[model samples]
Target: MAQLAQSITPVDAVVSRMRALDATLPERDGVAVFNRVYLAVTEEVDRHLDAGAFPDPEAAITLDVRFAERYLRVAEQGCPPACWRPLLQFRRHPGVRPLQFALAGINAHIGHDLALAVVDACRTLGCEPADLEDEFDRVGDLLISMEERIREDLMPGPDLLQIADPLTHLLGSWSLERARDATWSAARALWALRGLPDLAEEFCDRLDAAVGFAGRMLLTPLPD
Candidate 1:
């Protein structure tokens, strides 16, 4: 295990962990639903990296690894942040649709974890968020595409798109594009406050709680 860990790239290792989760988790499990979506996004990003798509593949790799590690850490831990609590708590709730599960996970990761991961990658790479702008935007673009695909694949058909449908409201409430923009701002804010550990920690805590609240809303139960 030690030798294998040393040889494996961070992205590869994270992808492996996600795959393991996919294999073990049941198809209807909420976390598994999100895991499947995330695994696809990660693989797509990996392919981009291999194709030399990013202007700074090293920085992109570092950012991607750090970003994935945040999610994996919360998943492996006994206690995760508020942003992850909803999904973990409702992983098997029958009323929550698969689309809800997937989007809630995206909300938490993009709204909360992504910002912190940006700061983490910055510290590791010894560069500012601006230095990672190209890689960040590229990754964000991929995520946007993933989000679009998720909606298409998971969203109910036109028959279910009535004005009274709860899913319609839920979908309208959260926007990945907006979340991506906010995450960039949050990342820059976090980088600025890096010198003040207390303030930074407080900011993160608030962000986590806020994102968690949003996740909880996204996972709202609907009638069968």
Candidate 2:
């Protein structure tokens, strides 16, 4: 298990793990839904890396691997951060929409795990968050683009877009752009607090709780 975990650093290896997970999960499983979306995004990132799209491929790979490991951890172990609890807890609830599951997972990932991934990459590369800014922005751009596509593909048609539709309101309530910005801020803040472990832990706890609250809201079951 330790060896397998260590071997997950390569993008191809991580992609394989996600693919295997995708095969095992039912189509409607909340974790599977998010995993499918994430797998596509990661594949795209791999393509970008192969094409030399990132200014520093090593840094990009490190960050991407570190970021992905968090989600993979949740799949391997039932344990997850507070921000992810709602999605996993309500994975099969009939009232929850697929789009809600995807967005809630994204909220947990971007709002919590991403900041830590940045710090992880920085520590591994012996650099600061600022040094990886370009890679971060590019990766973030891809996630934002994927999110736009997810909305278009998962959002209900116009007939369901009436003013009274809760899905519409729910969709409006969350913004990937806002989440991305906040994650970047949180990453820098976390990096600054690395020297103070106690304070850092407190900040992380608060962030986990706050993001979890948002995710819980996102996963609210809607009426048919």
Candidate 3:
């Protein structure tokens, strides 16, 4: 337990792991698409930590590492939560746009994994979600800031027919702000349910399935 805690406690090690993923994963793969987005966020968090932006840097590191580890674990184990299954299943579909892949991955991570990550951090630190609110909001803000860039960088070019693209409409339907807000609520609810283990597990499972449904929608393969 001590070694496991130590492994994920350092921001540098987490960033290194992400960089390694970026190096190894194929560019067009769905997991790779999400990894790039997540890697950028992790790198930004590292910068913020260096600049003393987080009031509780250790808590922040714990949350970030714990959150990322969930995703990495899924990749290694091939036993992802419901929220991530769609993205993984559709990763290689040529019809799924890069933008769709990125958004679906974000949906799974933010919608499902993030709530559980909050609970994981609280358990690790022997604290509560309220204690990590500042860090949560800060990390969320970084993710929100990156959403625009993700679209701009990944979206199909503005060719004549692309103006009326279905991907454009699909992308518009989901908002990072909404996802972040929902995650906060889910985190708080999960924390409240911590005393009731069975209930909390059921809630988490439901959340995972709901997020997976959304991911499936996001990955609706559009004709090229």
lDDT by residue (140-211, candidate 1, tens digit) is 999897787898899888877673388878778899999999999999999999999999999999999999
Q: Assess candidate 2 and give its TM-score to the true structure.
A: 0.94
lDDT tens digits by residue: candidate 3, 1-224: 12133233477887788888889889999999888888889989988877777878888889999998998888766888899999999999999988899999999999999999999999999998999999999999999888999989888676734643777888889998999999999999999998999999899989999999999999998886
With a 3 Å backbone cut-off (N, CA, C), the pairs that clash in candidate 2 are none
Predicted structure with the largest lDDT when compared to the true one: 2
Off by over 4 Å in 3: 1-9, 160-164
Give all candidates' CA lDDT scores: 0.88, 0.89, 0.88
Which 10 residues in a row give candidate 2 its minimum summed lDDT?
1-10
Give TM-scores for every candidate, taking all chains together and pairing residue i with residue i.
0.93, 0.94, 0.93
Worst 10 residues of 3 by lDDT: 1-10
Least lDDT summed over 10 consecutive residues: which range in candidate 1?
1-10
| Winner by TM-score between candidate 2 and candidate 1 | 2
User: Cα deviation in Å at residue 206, candidate 1?
Assistant: 0.6
Model 1, CA-based lDDT? 0.88
